[model samples]
Target chain A: MNLLEDTWKLEFHSGIPVYKQIIHHVQAAVAAGRLVDGDQLPTIRALHQQLNVNPNTVAKAYRELQHLGVLSAEHGSGCYIAPGAAEKSDGLSAREKKAKLTDLCARFAAEARSHGISFDDLVAQLKRQHPA
Target chain B: MNLLEDTWKLEFHSGIPVYKQIIHHVQAAVAAGRLVDGDQLPTIRALHQQLNVNPNTVAKAYRELQHLGVLSAEHGSGCYIAPGAAEKSDGLSAREKKAKLTDLCARFAAEARSHGISFDDLVAQLKRQHPA
Candidate 1:
């Protein structure tokens, strides 16, 4: 898959709002450097069709991203990744960072349990995610 | 901490709605058997104070859980974990399960990155979560 692909994997069962999830996906992509400054995103209509969600939902996500300074919009044009967004990394304190890791691990373990992924198999997958 | 403790470690920066996060925490607790049927939940005001979130947020989460049949309410008494909530597990298909795991891993990786957690450290933590 292309790093800049506009794929928005929507999980209806996650209990998170779809628009919020879209914002998360875009932010994560930006953090990973898969998206960078001035990179145009899919149009609201296009993204709506791609995700099978309401166009308004896509628009809301875009608007929220713009408000967060993560996206820039031009009149009658589309949104692009914002400048200096990549520089927003590494702002968290040590305690905040530890909390994030703990929260993430707990969430991952819970999902693995629900998916019937055994502890051993989960460890194997985790190793693959970070090969030596 | 006791499994039934009403402590909610909320991550305000996660972009997930606070109320939804509370709902997710409760559902995850139930799924892990840390919370079970007949388990009384903290009252709205109590949880609001505990998490330092709005009381309405806690009430909204409880209402949503009740609607989803995960919680039962009593007029004067408080909410309790609903019966048969545990048996509601494992209804997902293999494909759906795989998608969930993929989503989870990507999320974990993104968080691990933002937290400046080295891949080695992350793998070590994952290993600790699943001992022989």
Candidate 2:
């Protein structure tokens, strides 16, 4: 397969959003040995033109990919499929767990405040339990 | 205490990034009974104007907030603090666990393929273990 080919094979009827389809497409490409490290993806504008979607939608997809560290853009240039992304051994679980824990701690903090417990007091208890 | 105030009290010395600082500011407002649901936050453009930062930087902050379900924008109408955001109990842990499990499965799938085991066979083993 030509490494620089922009053949997305975009699908829109999977009940998943287009951005997600884009994400999965990239993941599938990586898995199937199509796209490799340091591949260049079309810019958001180019993708929007090719996919015939709103710029915001393409931007959203790009944003999601960027958030996942799958792509990076150079200002005045274009987005590139990030190198070494293939070797990333699936840390999504760890990130998801940490986000959940942040939310849990926020909730716990609110609850503790409602119960008139000092932040320090609650922190002490949590530290005692987890010992971090 | 003003609802529309853009007084971020920006703290650059904190270990967290500026965008995260913005997220925490909004979260703290909701938690501390300052900003309520449905409040209108400054637009990314306006925020960039106020903070003297690049539009991309402001957009990045807004995008992060939007990802967290904390903000929504109306075209031609600036971004608004998403309604009912305050009552959102932290589901960080659940999200984290699910992300972790997704990564685990992906790794397993890669390994299974490497070992010449069918995807169905590996999935069957996982289903047997989790029964989910």
Candidate 3:
């Protein structure tokens, strides 16, 4: 799990796409200034070994990040972080999404109450995940 | 745009999947107690008219919620909120995601700094979008 440690963690069943998940974690790191540019990402082979996933899957995730301009490979030095990668604005689209999403959730909860679904029951359902 | 209004708002970009985005908004509503279970969704026709999207897309999103047992449509009375539908534990997977995403973004930002990219440049890129 060195690769997992070196990079951000991952969850397979979060319902978010693998590549997007990677992007999210990377973006978060960039925004917070934990990862510096020119840092070498784990090699695809190394990541595959740690995650026990297919090489292609690792490659695909890396490729997606590269497409996002987050990662770049220079000759044999491995993949390095791009400069000035972090910093999405609080007023940008992402922040808007947070606002919209918050509003929607508030409404859904209200509607659920109008229907008589007990709060306890709702909590149970959300916490109860079928084991894989 | 009644359906859109009555429910949550949406955006096509942001890279999050449409269905998941809907789920996110609804989940938030439920968690925050805005949407109760048994709430009827807008008629497929209504949603289609507002978003100008295919009927199947709207149906698909609804069906997903139904499968999660969030909605129960009556034959003629329309969709109503389900009882006690709004509630998910803050400790569950979602909260974890927030943490991981935050961590990742921080790292990415640091990496960018190491590469000598200014924070201003990063902010500009996020705000600038290629027009469709």
Model 1 chain A: weakest 10-residue lDDT segment is: A117-126
C-alpha RMSD in Å of predicted model 2 compared with the true structure: 15.8
Off by over 4 Å in 3: A1-8, A87-132, B1-132
Model 3: what is its DockQ? 0.03
Candidate 2 per-residue lDDT, tens place, B1-132, comes to 453364776666644457755665665565455666777777777767776767887777778778767778778887777877665523233234234434443453454444333333333233233211
- Candidate 1 residue-wise lDDT, B18-108, digit = tens: 8877876776676667778898888887888777889999999999889878899897899999998766556554455446666677677
Give the per-residue lDDT of model 3 (tens digit) for A46-70.
8778767787877787787776677
Cand. 1 Cα-lDDT? 0.71
The residue ranges of model 2 lying beyond 4 angstroms of the native Cα positions read: A1-132, B1-6, B89-132
True contacts kept of each: 0.33, 0.00, 0.00
Clashing pairs in 2: A93-B99, A93-B100, A96-B96, A97-B96, A100-B92, A100-B93
TM-score of each: 0.40, 0.34, 0.37
List the DockQ of the predictions in order.
0.16, 0.03, 0.03
Question: What digit string (tens of lDDT, one per residue) describes model 1 on residues A1-132?
Answer: 233365456878755678877876776677667778998888888888878999999999899888878899886988898998766656554345556766677777777876655444455455556544
Please report how far candidate 2 places residue A39 from its true position, in Å: 46
| Worst ten in a row by lDDT for model 3 chain B | B123-132
